[model samples]
Every structure is written in structure tokens, then in C-alpha cells.
Target: MKAFAQVFACLFCIALAGVSVAQDAASSTLTDAEQAFVDQMTESVLVGQFSVDGRSDRAPKPERYSIQSVTKTSDDNWIVQARITYGKYDLPVPVPVQVIWAGDTPVLQVTDLKIPLMGEGFTARVMFYKDRYAGSWYHGKVGGHMWGSIERQSPDEGSKTPESESSESDE
Candidate 1:
């Protein structure tokens, strides 16, 4: 009877440890403020202008980005799925960026982020606040500034479908 009691006590401790591990895993999700930021950014549109280096004389045209989703993988990292329209090309890319906070503001930072067919020198540090975002971008030797407002898209605003996924725009 003494040996049986020892074995049962050991088994009970092991079960408690397993439950603790499971609870820890369940608590690894983002906090409330982080979730709020993610909710505001998802399914939003960024409308802005970008300029190339040494081209200050030309007027900056309109640039548009459709933010499809934002998924938080960890406390400070997130993956953003976006459709970027440049000139006549529409590129859908998954951008992994780091989120840092300055007081109550959230900033998205990307360092040397490479996009397929868009080269490997892309870098951006953008801050989002009050429905607005402003940032600077670098592409190899050419660098520029971008600032825009976030517009939430309604369900009837012609969002991109899965069948419309392509490297080039249909228009």
C-alpha cells in the first residue's frame, strides 16, 4: 500500500504540470490594445503618394494599397497581407513587420523587406494614428516618403477575390 501511494502522488504532480503548460500556451495571444490596432488596420485602404529620388520636380501621383489582413504571430511581430498597386502592376505580398509602441502610438517597422518582382531593397518605418499613416521607404539607391489616410472598405467596395489573384492588374 505504501508503494501504491507514492506512485499515485507522482502521477498527480505530472498532471498538474501538464495543465500549467497548457494554460501558458493559451495566454500567449495579443493583449487588448494590440488586438485593437490589428482590427483597425485589417481590410483597410491606404491612399498616398510616393516619389523617386532626384525626381522632385515631377508631381507625385496617387498610390493605393489594400490591406487584406493582419495576423499577430507573437507579441511584437505581425504578418500583413496587402495588395499594392504600382503604375499598372498589382502585387500581392505578405509583409512581416515588427510593431513598436511610442506611448500610445503604434509604429510598423520593416527592415530590408524583399518582395517578389519588386526587388530586395524595400524598407519602411510607418506610424499609424488617428486614421492616418506616414512613413519613409527605401529601394536600393532610391528612397522616398509616403503618407496617407486609412479608409475602411465596405463589403460592397469591390474587394479582391481569390480568383483575381495575379501578378498583373486585369485592367
Candidate 2:
């Protein structure tokens, strides 16, 4: 009976140690810079314009990305939960992107990512610096350049539609 008790206690201690290791890993996974980026992007809006490669005559269309959250899943992987409002479509998508750094700047890369209603073979390389982001995006044969400013949103403000966001951008 005493031997059995000792074995059970050892197993319990090992389980507790495993939980502690997991907690430590979870807490320390993201570096300070990465955590700051996550904080900056959560509940924020990217308001900007996108230009098609051959559509110079057409005015750049208004674009808005309402970020619900940005979470780092691994060293180079992040999931950006954002509501994309552009053209006539509004979609809330959890975008899995690869993050690579250039010095202190973090660039988000999406290669041939397909979202429902958006079609397939979508690729983009976007980088953030301070309060702005710029990138090139490709979908099928249509590709373009996109640039925009990031605006922090209050929790109660809620996400805006393209028309409403466009009006604000016009001002």
C-alpha cells in the first residue's frame, strides 16, 4: 500500500510539472515586439485604397479591414481575424499568414489563400510600420497594390460597412 501511494504521488507531481511547463511556454511564446504588434492590430481598422494593375483610369476603390484580433500561433505563424469590407462584399475571415521580419518591421505573407466567396489563389505580402501598411495582392489574374493607415477602434464603435467607411475616408 505504501509503495502504491508513493507511485501515485510521483505521477501527480509529474502531471503538475507538465502543466507548469505548458503555462510557461504559453506566456513566453510571443516576444515583446510581436506582442506589441498584436496589441496594435486588435480592434483596429485599416482604411486605405487599392489600385489594379491596368486600371489607372478608374479611381482607387475604398477599402476597410476591421481587425477583431491578431494572435500569434507559432514563431512565424499568426491568425488575423478581420472583417474585410471592399466592393460589394463584406466578409469576416480568419486569415492565416506567415510573418517574417525585416529588421524591426513585420511583413504578413499570404500565398494562394482561398476564402469562401473570395475565390482561390489569393496571395499578398503586406508590411506594417507605425500606423500604416502597404502591400501587393494577387487573386487569379487580377493583382494590385494596396496602402492604408491603421486606426484604433473603440470596442463599442463596432465594424462599419464599406459605404459608411468610404464616406469617412472622403472627409
Best by lDDT: 2
| TM-score of each model, in listed order | 0.68, 0.75
What C-alpha root-mean-square deviation, in Å, does candidate 2 show against the real structure?
17.1
For TM-score, the strongest prediction is 2
Tens-digit lDDT track for model 2 on 45-120? 7767777788888877656566766766667876766655444655456667677889888888878776565455
Clashing pairs in 2: none
Worst 10 residues of 2 by lDDT: 9-18
* lDDT per residue as tens, model 1, 48-71: 655555777876544455666666
Clashing pairs in 1: none
